[model samples]
Target: MAAPARPYRIGTGAGFSSDRLGPALDLVRDGRLDCLVLECLGERTVAFAHRDKRADPAKGYNAHLEKRLKQLLPLCRAKGTRIITNMGAANPRAAALKTVEIARALGLTGLKVACIEGDDVSAIVPMSTPLYDEPGTLADVGLQLVGMNAYLGADAVLPALEAGADVVIGGRLADPSMFLAPLMHHFGWRADDAALAGAGTLVGHLMECGMQVTGGYFADPGVKEVDRLADCGFPIAEVAADGTAVITKLEAAGGCVTPATVKEQLLYEVHDPARYLTPDVTADFSRVRVEEIARDRVRVSQASGRERPASLKVTVGFDDGWHGEAGVSYAGPGAQGRGELAARIIEERIRKAHAVAADLRVDVIGASSLFATAGLKAQAAQDVRVHAAMRSRNREDIETLLWEVESLLCCGPAGGGGYRGAITPCVMTKSVLVPREKVRPTLEVMIA
Candidate 1:
């Protein structure tokens, strides 16, 4: 006989940080939640991973996530709760093996752990093509691609749960997968079940950001005396088989889950409400309804989702042209005047050298420099400081820009002497977008 259908309480833990583990485990133990979802990798995390991997090949997965998992995994297993996390980052297999080792060290054997991967973009991007579009090729604006992560949908995770994994982990999957997997497991929802898929998507969207859907992002006037924000609890979704969920937080936790908070999170980073795209399905956010409930809870219901496409979109990174910036500070009497003169001197020197800096930013600290010019009158600062930064598309241009700064110290105002330090050169990579069909998901089952 199949396991009985159970109402699942899904909680999304905060991003990869050691400090959040104790409280997250406490909520799981106290609330008896069915599943825990942890989101860790981001743009900054990807950059950090790339740098660390270059320094040491073994360093790929976020260490903080591993630390948290070590403490929570055994406790969760003891409490009969499953976990789905996207803490794998660039190395899902390695992460899975490490987790299994941790479980073994804890004297927990025969624990089923599943790893979902194949969302890498490193090999697909072409060497000739720029990561971002050049002028007239794709668009006038170009975005620098520090890291490209695939937004894999929940399908990859369902198989793991069906295979009887107590814990499932993935690398760079969409935020919603963490919540959707538990729903699929408890309800036995098929891949093409549009209504159930839509419901799961709604639940995932509502609680994906943890505290954001509760009271952390709320701007409601009815809320009062929200205390202990430092200890604010993350959001949880109690999902029923009928495709509806009650969004709430831990009991005795800070923050309030009002309709306003739900609405704010619904709109966060969403480009189009009617056609919010995900790997599993195209969710129609316009149909979502939020109702306030008693005691800091809200009902999220009536969302519609369309069928998912055959493949996923992949983000790839490659070598872009080199660029860097140099900056110096000026402070004291007549600092503003000296900084302005120094800027002019540097500009003249760059012009004389025939090097064009792609971008330049100048700031006069405390001078109210552009308030009047921008139609806001304000007092001019008595003692001001100035900071300037410049960027270019090539290393030679940057080197020339750095050389011009030293000349300003001698030719510009005497107060310019405050400027000091060696200008350093920074290199950035270009990234490309590819289709998911090009990347294959690697699956591994480990026995703990």
Candidate 2:
């Protein structure tokens, strides 16, 4: 494939699992993008996806996949924009099938949707596998294994693009690689070209989080004020063949893309600036340049790279039982004191009365919740909320915890009102490494 004379334009649709759909639709309808990448999966999200797949084989992909694609497909098809996404979660084939059905229902005849699989390494990894982040083996977790998926890189996605897939969906596709694959495919970038890989990875890393670089997460009202934040737009990357990109958003969209926003996102999840490891390359963003050339447009360049990692990281998902939370707010005089008293009461009830041996936590929000573990305490405020939460392998234990907290409405505290409680299934995740050769990605295109 020859590189186009003009820059290759791409944009992000959804950043996280439940990211707003309006911004994505805005980008697709007007951004003139060659491709739109929807990065929806997170570590815990994949774990929950496995749990979802366990309960119902037809489920497990992103919960909003249908809603996103139902709106995105026709617009993208009409605009001649390809889509690459990791919305497949724990099940790529099913997600692709669902896409086919949606496309058919929309009267999108002969639309090609590629399903990429083989990220699941549940059978490939053993119980004795040592976790990369902690000092424990998989067996040491003592939780039911939900699933294990290796991070598939641009190499795994390139074949589908080569096959002319309009939409490419996969499980555990590396976040950056979703963006990198399209660039490499469009520019005919060699997999071994570490420098190009680094540049592409840089573009991916910046754009993968959608609006983060466009001021959605960068807003600090009265400090780093963003105008019209309620209408914040997703990011767009206009990439040159050499890998430099100008990160910008729609002219009519809200939010500003200044150097600060770009810089914050550049180092968002990077533990090491010189060696940010993705499946595609070891990106070196330490000396990357960020230049705000125009309003709501920043040019990022000088990102370099070394060889890719020898092993691919695998996210091991486990069924972590249930999590319950209940909160009661208080206001006016002595509100802080009442909230703190409520927190203590709930703690005692869960620990002593219920005798539930779970990981229980109580916090007096507006007083000392966010920084409680850091030993930082805030002065008492007139408005406060007593929040109690717990996690347990047994559903009954979680229920008891919730019940005891709700009982505070009458049993304890002077004015405990505005009570809210919820119970949700939980999932835990761990990282492990596997030889890259062991995980083989397979691609199949389904037409609708």
Candidate 3:
């Protein structure tokens, strides 16, 4: 494809489900973006939202949906920057309506909000879809199913853009597709152009994490120190029609965007470098090229891809069990030894009381916890904390296990203090594959 007359600027507003709101607002107010996207929601996040929908239908979408739209609608309207987001989680329709309400409340008339849906395949998933990793189909574990959603792609989002939507809301669309759709819509790129789509997808992946490509998670303190981390700005990609992109944050923005940061993000959460599968295309990152073309700017190009996958990856969430945890603090001399002894006491007490959980752990927070104690002894910490956790099939088992640890405050360790415990419902997740044709996503518009 020939290069466009001018590159399109896309700004990543939100990376995850609970990213900071102020930085995203900064992007809309000042980033000069053609499209602003919030790539919220993880694999199991929609499933959790599904359970929320079951309790109260209006509560499934992003909690800050109204507040965000109310604040940005007028600004985005004035800037002519379209907004795209996967904040819909399990309920895009509700999200669309909520946006309308916010717009009307702000007296912003003639605003078009589009809701993208049909990604939920929970009803049909139990028919024949088998787990991607483990054996057996969803029917075998139907009783345990909490929620199921198929990952949708860019094609599913194009119609909303075509509808002249001021804002687009999506439920469980792929993370990159929120940014990829605008690129496809603006450039008129064919869906099957694997290389072009791959390039765009690469840009989406890089920017999807918001500040990660701009040094949020890349900061390593002394080794990879960054500037003004508290005020770190989200990334913006200037994407050419050829699918090449230059990543950078706003001038005077607080984060680094060196080739080192960009390079690390390229491989984050990537399972297979050769076949990074997505609903839009199977991107090949093996031969991709990255270079620092300017200060705080990195150019990404030559991302090749093959044919798209026939099946969509489906994430299934179910009731894992119960998890109960409790913690205590040890201080002064011999704190580490006291912490270790407290952990052992909790484990032994649970075992003796027949409240031992199926899986149990005692962690010494200060010494020999993360690395595990397997070798020679080490010096005691000035202060140490002991945390114990247990997982079981029911709340009673977990609670029983936690109570044993909580009792340690008075009955077990000498310096045991600050006791705390809780029993919470735990959800497990598994992956499966469903035919691409089965999803059948749709886009519907709501105007205010």
Write down the TM-score of every candidate.
Answer: 0.78, 0.97, 0.96
Task: Please state every model's RMSD to the true fold in angstroms.
Answer: 5.2, 1.7, 2.0
Best-fitting candidate, scored by lDDT: 2
lDDT by residue for model 2 (123-184), tens: 88899999997898999999889899999999999999999999999999999999999999
Tens digit per residue, CA lDDT, model 1, 1-448: 9874566888777644233665587677776788888887664455556555566666677687667778888888888888788777766777788889889998889988999986765555443434444333212225344445566777678778888898887887777767776788788788788767777888887777777765665543565445566667787788888778888887777777878778888878788887776787777788888898777778888887887765565444322444444444567665666666666666666766665745655555565445625755224344554455566566676666665665556665675544542444333433344555776666788999
Least accurate 10 contiguous residues by lDDT in model 3: 369-378
Give lDDT per model, in order. 0.69, 0.93, 0.86
Model 3: residue 352 alpha-carbon error in angstroms: 1.5
**Which candidate number maximizes TM-score?**
2
Clash pairs of candidate 2? none
Better of 2 and 3 by TM-score: 2
